[model samples]
Target chain A: MKKSDVIRAVFHSLLQEAPNKVWQPQHEKGLGFAPTNIALCKYWGKRDIELNLPMTSSLSIALPDKGALTSVSLHDQSYDRIILNDQEVVRDSAFAVRTSQFLDLFRPQKTGYLQIDIKMNIPVAAGLASSACGFASLVSALNDLFDWKLKKQSLSILARLGSGSAARSFWNGFVEWYAGVRPDGMDSFGEPLAFEWPELCVGILTMSEVEKPISSREAMQRTVNSSLLYGSWPKKVAQDLAILKQAMQVTNFPLLGGTAESNALTMHATMLSSWPPVCYFMPETIAAMHKIWKSRKEGLELYFTQDAGPNLKLLFLEQDKEQVQQLFPSVDIVKVFE
Target chain B: MKKSDVIRAVFHSLLQEAPNKVWQPQHEKGLGFAPTNIALCKYWGKRDIELNLPMTSSLSIALPDKGALTSVSLHDQSYDRIILNDQEVVRDSAFAVRTSQFLDLFRPQKTGYLQIDIKMNIPVAAGLASSACGFASLVSALNDLFDWKLKKQSLSILARLGSGSAARSFWNGFVEWYAGVRPDGMDSFGEPLAFEWPELCVGILTMSEVEKPISSREAMQRTVNSSLLYGSWPKKVAQDLAILKQAMQVTNFPLLGGTAESNALTMHATMLSSWPPVCYFMPETIAAMHKIWKSRKEGLELYFTQDAGPNLKLLFLEQDKEQVQQLFPSVDIVKVFE
Candidate 1:
């Protein structure tokens, strides 16, 4: 695959055929990569100044089809190029400042024009780690350039500094961010809560025209400070985490799903009690719940969870996925971007 | 005095002047009494079915001015003289049916009536125990005909059958109905969370209104069934009740006022989660909460609570009363009518 090897092999053919050759050496190159993350049992409070830990266990996040990727080959010598979401990242001076800050946290030594074109399919701010997708793209490219053979956790440590939830991107399947009792009080550092078993799968029903009306950062802090109901929620989170890990071990819907639903409801209930209050459910969102609850009440086992936005993530037993899907045929499935 | 003493006095009066002695008869002389009960801490929500026990503590309530009274004296009566709120109670058949139901709950073991006269001044369910007042009044006159020495508690037991909260009307301040953990469950009778503490005073903010959109009976039942947050609430009721009582004992404004705000908020929160979703707050009700929150956030130190209606029940430390009232000089003030 060496350029010299190709040139030598072609040289003989070129000399024999008497073909003309032009040098015109003028192109720059860099790298690009992106990763995905899934929420474990812990969900962060949006408003906590520190991007504090979750109130309960929420499972199932849809990741990008392939992965975040971009080609950094220069189109010209002097003019460097960058691409994002499959479009050329324009040269904005402010983006320059932000990119530097982003790089410092994501990839310190590997810096330049980062002549790259990016293509990402991750949904932005839809209660998914879009930031991680972007940072993973940038970080993975730098790791390639500097040959920094670091493990995923080490990379995630860099990601965490850029965006707190970004640490979860390093692992696949059932993740947990241990809220360590650190003196510096950073608390959260992500780790996988459970290993993957192919039987465990997830499907989401997104009900949002946009991300959430309020950011998770603002919402969580308000609840922690203003809500009288806040004290009781963290306990529920612990219980949910325990129940979920056990459920994943046993590999059953009854225990696993019931725990997830309880945790999701508790988290939404916390939102309802915050100072100004925010309703995460639309009529359709609740309609979805009614459909699930009715089906279950009629003795069908279907389960769902909701994030800060209107998305309803269904957790069905791998055995009953088709049946559950048929039960909710009216619901529009969200095309998983990331 | 004694029946004979009453008879002698009547005869003497007749001799002294050919007085207009309208001789009203007994058993044969149809009569009834109606009395009002006051709620101190206030009763909300039903616990047991057959016997009504509330989940929260409440206080004893008697007629504030005196026993709530209404007299229905039989005289082959002139149609049906109904006087209330200084207006003739209209001769409506529906009204008659309702009146009869009130009488039927406690008519001396098959007492019948042909004609009657009625009068009362108590305000009806404008968040006032007018029914208690009316029922208490009807029964007091009947006490004359039957010569029954019914204690107030016994009468309250009967009144409670009419409207459970009216049980508070039969007694004075500092009354409590112990929700005994009996096999059959003792009556969740009207009980006082606080009695006649000389320093404990209440100032009401009365508004011009007829009644709430939903009755307590319907609202409470719907709320208990519909609130997903319901289960979590009962867990804290015991603690809330204990804390509020302690606050009352010490006249601790922060403790008492804050707890009251929380309890009232939660009661309404349950209403919002009702099956069809009931908003007990009038537009004015919401505006009041806005004002209080805005003012307090601005360091004005003002707050309010609403019953199941539009009128605002502003809560402030006794020490802050003057300033609080000054902030809304237009709001009317009334006694708790305990």
Candidate 2:
């Protein structure tokens, strides 16, 4: 249903009760939300999403404090209008279709004000888990309005319905999402590690480029099917998972870093060797890694791990932040983000 | 000085001293001898050997029975005389100089009856390690006839002086050369992995064509002086050596395979990324790897590897040899060298 009709109906109903007050939905208030997450170990290929059979499972942490929160409200009034820059605007079909699919479950009636303002500054839909935050926001808004009071884990299911990675954002620190083969999707979700593994510090080195990323959805599908090394996927992932879990327990940097980096390379190489190669690592990305390894040889506790994006996420000592920052180039814009 | 001269001198020297012996140097030796390694793991710069250091510290095995060996002797007769094809033939400076060097080391007379003849079935000067076996034969003939009793290790040093990888031909199985920093050429040569780790099985797959390889000497020099990744050399070699040694201890096939394969890619990548790129993999070689990986996804235990050459060495269980062989388009001509 159109936002105008929904807004008109909401005000119409409210007008019935008060016979005077009128309000309308605003575009700035976005309706979806999800938490932020970084995979300690990552999942690559999927064996079966029907059962969440992941090629590999990874440990991830959810960021809550700085994450986005979405708010949506419906008000009556309308000229059957959509607006951009205070001017009429039209909705995109695919996006609208996707949003409508989720909105239908919460509000069967179209009458309402539509406000969609996403407050979090964290990037979404690229390497970072932006969709997790966005969808989480949407799901949360629906839950808040309906008084669903769903548990965090239960809400994650709804968030995941929009994007698979959202499940990781539901949990706090270090969680493992098992890529199991059980027929029901319920078999795989977030299970947190201990509340704290104090020695962990991850440094994100975002490249300077702001160009839109090739959507992960399309890349992953292409890599999974067209990579020359595609067949090694499940087996390699299975092997990596066993080692990854052990590394998390012991916090073995070598084991953890080596496997993580190699897995990332394999993931990227899948794209390079695809039938139609797709390169996401910019010259900056390659240079950043070179510098990190060069620094690593100098006895700094620095290791880099990448996730599908050009940004170089470095894992280093907390004490070495400033020194590490000094060593890094192309990261001119730095923010002390958690 | 050249092939013809070396052949002539050796021919004459053997006829003079040994009176009727033949000196045959093996053909088909390899040059790219890096352990299975990666560029990211080692060198990085756009320059060369300087940046990435050496593309590899390869581990290889020499064919004991199949490669060539020669015997030579000198006798008091006329000027240096050469005999080959069962007849006295004109000797050139190419054969003369190399044979003369060996002669000077033994029977020191400039003019003497030297009888030397070479019988080699393997392709001469091919990337197949022709130089390896050839040089080893040259040194072996010099050592044997004169009762120099040179140790295999000593012969390796001499062979390496002749060509970086030829020295490795003295051994039969898993061997690695330590490319170290002792300046007077003291710290680099191949050594065998101790016999305790005997599970090492090498599969030698020969590409149909036999062409010249980038002499490890030229390639290493280029890599050491020009590659951007040069600084990472010591650490990379240290890391690969340690990892490979560990793999040796546990005999982990997949780890060893990946490490070796990645190393080979690193070596080649550095070459291609050089000012002028050179490729060692053909479409056929790529196809072979793809086929093997395809089989692996279907649950096969076959593993394949390659050196600087296009030949792909495939390893499989004795039971599955036939099945594994069938995957390649060239099974009919594939020679399984035990």
Candidate 3:
């Protein structure tokens, strides 16, 4: 059968169950999986909210097959319901409200109510970009169910409206988010890099499984609004992003590791400069960083990056993964991307 | 006796023991005590090395009677000797070398050697600006012994040659260090505030009594050379200083405290952005900050500022001192400043 005929047949089946003016399927479902991306060059602040535009361009490596799996199914309920990890999410909760709002972006005007079930293997709110994976997977699944026929780039644009970092999750391997010029953000989307470093390994030093006190969105807004050192962040990120991209293209491990670590520190610097200062480094985090530095001095070839929370993500080559694992015995080894 | 006549007589008496260099003086002595100043608006990075000029203007409150006391006496020996806290400081030590270099700035073409003794009650190198008080006290004592007839501004300038923060220590109450445009840096010195907030109270949260791993000088140099966020710091500091001065003039505790805390955080942010990132906040330092924040949220008017080390200096009203002291059981109530 032709691809168009397959899509038409699926839609015809989806419309069979309705008894009213518009028929709807009781159980038409689509599912998708997407992984979170660890930003080597951080995206800290925004230029516009309506278009979800970033103030700085960023580079990240996608962690495939170790993120969120989301399923969307048409239901008989009058309102949409969200179930997270086998539990019904409270409708008035911030997480539920945010997830519902994100889904509304894809809801067609005359569509029937749908139920979303998100199963996250990655811990949410642990500075691991679980939201990014969750939203990306949800968008992907909804697109598949409705036969939206949206291209990857268009999917990325839609995902960014849910979360800025979610846009980068649509791609595989290394991805770059362009800090586009248009006010409408028509040009802003993630693009996979031309080259890939297959030997790269990542070790996630998860400090806590609990949710962070301050959300990344709130932290970014605070830094943008009040941090004294925030003025030059965009230009600094741009410079680092250029250097990082070149290093990645050439597979320069030292350059890539150093640039990513430095860029992460620079991002934290803006948070530290915010009024009442947002400090995320716990004692364990500092100790972890010290161990990484010590290992590097002893020729282990390892570097680390931190996001808005206390957890750390260390990057190294496949040859040095064992050594990195030994040095941080407390941390979990994330093997999906490796 | 007349002041000039008294100075001459003192110098004449010093000539009794000195057989060379035209027999200047033998027993002339002077003593001074000066407390360190905590920069409410931090002075980081430098504009000039030779003259010790600051990159940006800063404000501070001198903590009188809570620092170092030094005595300088003319001696018959051919060389000068320094004894700190009753122990002879080694000539090759950084402190000794820096002190000698500072004294050389005061030496005329031909002058007799002197014996100096310094007693410091405050902990050294723990981010309490011990050097500032030590150098300021030494300079003040030397000025009196030699009858230099220097004004407070001139004394501040001389003291700044030893330590940048030392210039602010020369004044009682509040002080400001001007980041001068002059190449010679003659105009860059500390000036006392015309108005004073006598009812203010301070609590020093001393996390460690030991010396810090990295000195402020080395940390500042690292930040200036490598920190990506440091590019726009001077301008930000200048803007904050203006607001701080206005707040001081009005005796507005909220403005003064808030600005001080924000400025200190901004200063540390630059350090955290350095290539290796000179982060000084221990877990206790963060805890102290949180306590202050919590108290503030509970309706207490309190704020905090930190210098180059782990300690936190809290600013509050006299009425709030007891309550503030109760919150942080480990903190020291600095009665001298209050």
RMSD of each: 14.3, 16.6, 7.0
Q: How does each model score on TM-score?
A: 0.52, 0.48, 0.90
Q: Mark the regions of model 1 whose C-alpha exceeds 4 Å error after superposition.
A: A1-40, A46-48, A51-122, A132-138, A184-187, A330-338, B1-338
lDDT of 1 by residue, B1-338 (tens): 54333333432332343233223244544355444443434455767533445666554424345435555455443344556655665667544555665554333224444244455443355555555566555554555554454555555544554556656655554456554454232244444444344433344555536765566767778767765555555544555567767866776755655565655565565555444454455544554565666677677545455456546566554555666677667654333323
Candidate 1 per-residue C-alpha lDDT over A45-104 given as tens digits, one digit per residue, 9 for 90 to 100: 533233233433334343535346645432333434555565555567433344555543
**Ranking by TM-score, best first?**
3, 1, 2
Candidate No. with top lDDT: 3
Select the stronger candidate by TM-score from 1 and 3.
3
Sort the predicted structures by lDDT, highest score first. 3, 1, 2
lDDT of model 3 at position B209: 83
Candidate 3 residue runs with Cα over 4 Å from true position: A1-27, A294-300, A335-338, B1-27, B75-79, B108-112, B336-338
The candidate maximizing DockQ is 3
Top TM-score prediction, candidate number: 3
Candidate 1 CAPRI category: incorrect
The residue-by-residue lDDT of candidate 3 on A18-137, one tens digit each, is 313232332378787888899999989999764568998888988776789999888877667989899998889988888766654434454567788999988888899988898899
- TM-score-best of 2 and 3: 3
After TM-score superposition, the amount by which residue A47's alpha carbon in candidate 1 deviates from its true location, in angstroms, is 11
Q: Each model: TM-score of chain B?
A: 0.71, 0.67, 0.89
Q: Clashing residue pairs in candidate 3, if any?
A: A18-A24, B14-B25, B14-B26, B15-B24, B15-B25
